[model samples]
Target: MPKKLIQRFSPKPETLKAHPHLKYFGEILQNPNLWHLNRRSAAGAVAIGLFCAWMPIPFQMLLASLLAMFFCVNLPLSVALVWISNPITMPPLFYGAYRLGASILNEPIREFHFELSFHWLAHAIETIAPALLLGSFILGVISAASGYFMLRILWRINIANKWQRRNKK
Candidate 1:
């Protein structure tokens, strides 16, 4: 005897409309051009956003968002990318920046310490003064370019699979 076929069903439109955030999510999900965006453009935006986000610059999130919007990238994703150098990751990220600066300038790695004394602010500035500007920019650019290429390759593979599935259907 032959087996019966099973039919799968999608959620109804009314069910989707009930959730508030779903409306926005649905808009992105239904955009036909989402997959059509050029891989290079997507990659470039991701790279630039990630780079700007990871830099030790102040107001990095604002900068990344502005750049993302300026570049016509997915703003949410770019903003989310800012966590690349959050509190948890700051140690290694800043260390890498210091190392990069030291290697370039042939200088020894400077020791960093934080104290609550009245003069702590002045001391901190004196320690990090020289390397802050250049180190942050170099590392930001490197990380951003790396993130862009990595994300591009992954996205391409994912989009290709999706395209193949759509074609098959």
Candidate 2:
């Protein structure tokens, strides 16, 4: 990861500390690990963020933030990455997860029309919740592991390249 790039874009600790809503978090937000842009923190944040992004629930950012805090990872990066499943990509991602889950469970795929109502949501959940949850969990784990390892590998490679150039100098 480009530490400077991430640091530049991430919210400043002072800004977060000054926010009224964030005041509830108090000293917890003051943890140095949560703001550090090092390899381990960055990789762990990626894993935490990606995993939460696949979750079939509201407030993925909150989940990512909590996980980041618990794991002592980069907090802002983890929360920001949960936007991967925003309004535009959510439908397709959930649909794919549902399909994968149904296949894994050997259940027949059902064709249902979408409706913007509480009744429809309730009915849909009753029929599809199992497969959707299962598939989402599977995908989340895969995404988290892939993100963690990929970041770790890329960070190591970047360091090695920098070392080589310095040696040549």
Candidate 3:
């Protein structure tokens, strides 16, 4: 008969120290009463970040950071989250925005014929410029505000649950 080897169940210490940025790594962390405050700020930041990401405007990350600071949100995290929109997603998002804006304005959707030249690009811009700007701003504000409210509710519930758990212990 062959002998079977048993694996140890101990967790590695390095794996446990996951988030280095957090103040308390493995210690008994004290619960703070300012839970609602932090939660609201974080929620607002995430919401604004997502909106900024989806907006077709240039330099969106910078705009998001400035907005986050002005709105008193978690600036670093909000700005970081704005990367949700990248080059890969830009084309589809811009197309959708254009469609929406054209529909709303009772204008027929213009079809683009892509050519391998800078002249074609300039023509495309001239055609869609108005719709792009209008749609991007509208969608950005709508998405951002929606995200803010949804996150706010979620954070409130989570914080309340944590507060209750700490009190129970």
Candidate 4:
């Protein structure tokens, strides 16, 4: 099986425990289920991470961790996937999400520059926030479901291929 995709980023439980931010989850973060690299856990981790990455808020990684803890997925994988919306990709990703939202809502897609200032935020909230929020939520659901199933299918194929090779041997 192509297990190394996960193992490349999957940190040891002790390594996570040593991280300062994870200290907030207390003993809950230490659960064995949260660290398991099995198919179910890994798929759920991708789903949870994808969903949380679409959130229009700060501390996305923290939120992903919290959701993974709640849903019993691989914690490190959940944290890593939120990098999908990292600063470098944020503008285009969010703009696409906003466009999707506007199209779904049948609202006019607003044209605005991507700016991080408070004035821009306030203006955006008044103008495109509704479409943006709706679009992001919908996109998140779609992304999470896609990631979950994609991982599951790939994992299944990998295992099947491995078994076939072993039988040939």
Q: What is the clash count for each candidate, in the order shown?
A: 0, 0, 0, 0
Which candidate would rank higher by lDDT, 1 or 3?
3
Q: Which stretches of candidate 4 lie over 4 Å from their true place?
A: 114-119
Q: How many backbone clashes does candidate 4 have?
A: 0
Q: What ranking emerges by lDDT with the best candidate at the front? A: 2, 4, 3, 1
Q: Give the CA lDDT, 0 to 100, for residue 151 in model 4.
A: 93
lDDT of 4: 0.88
| Candidate with better lDDT, 3 vs 4 | 4
Model 1 Cα lDDT, one tens digit per residue, 41-146 = 5576567667876577788877875675466664445655687778888877777777777677777777777688869868866667556656777878887878
Angstrom error of the Cα, residue 65, model 3: value is 1.7
Q: What is the lDDT of candidate 3?
A: 0.67
Query: Tens digits of per-residue lDDT for model 2 on 1-169?
Result: 5889888899998998899988899999999999888999999999999999999999898899989989999999999999999999999998999999999999999898999999999999998988999999999999999999999999999999999999999
**Per-residue lDDT tens digits of candidate 4, residues 1-169?**
3568668756779988888986887899779999888899989999999998888889999899889988988888899899889888888888888999899989997778868899998998988999889989999999999999999999899899989999999
What lDDT does each candidate get? 0.63, 0.94, 0.67, 0.88
Runs of candidate 1 with Cα error greater than 4 angstroms are 1-41, 116-118, 163-169
- Per-residue CA lDDT of model 3 for 1-169, tens digit only, reads 0001101222222442354643352342122211113656667777878888877778898788667656766555576668877888888887888888887777789988669899996986788767877787777788788887887777677668879999999
User: What value does the lDDT take at residue 105 in candidate 1?
Assistant: 73
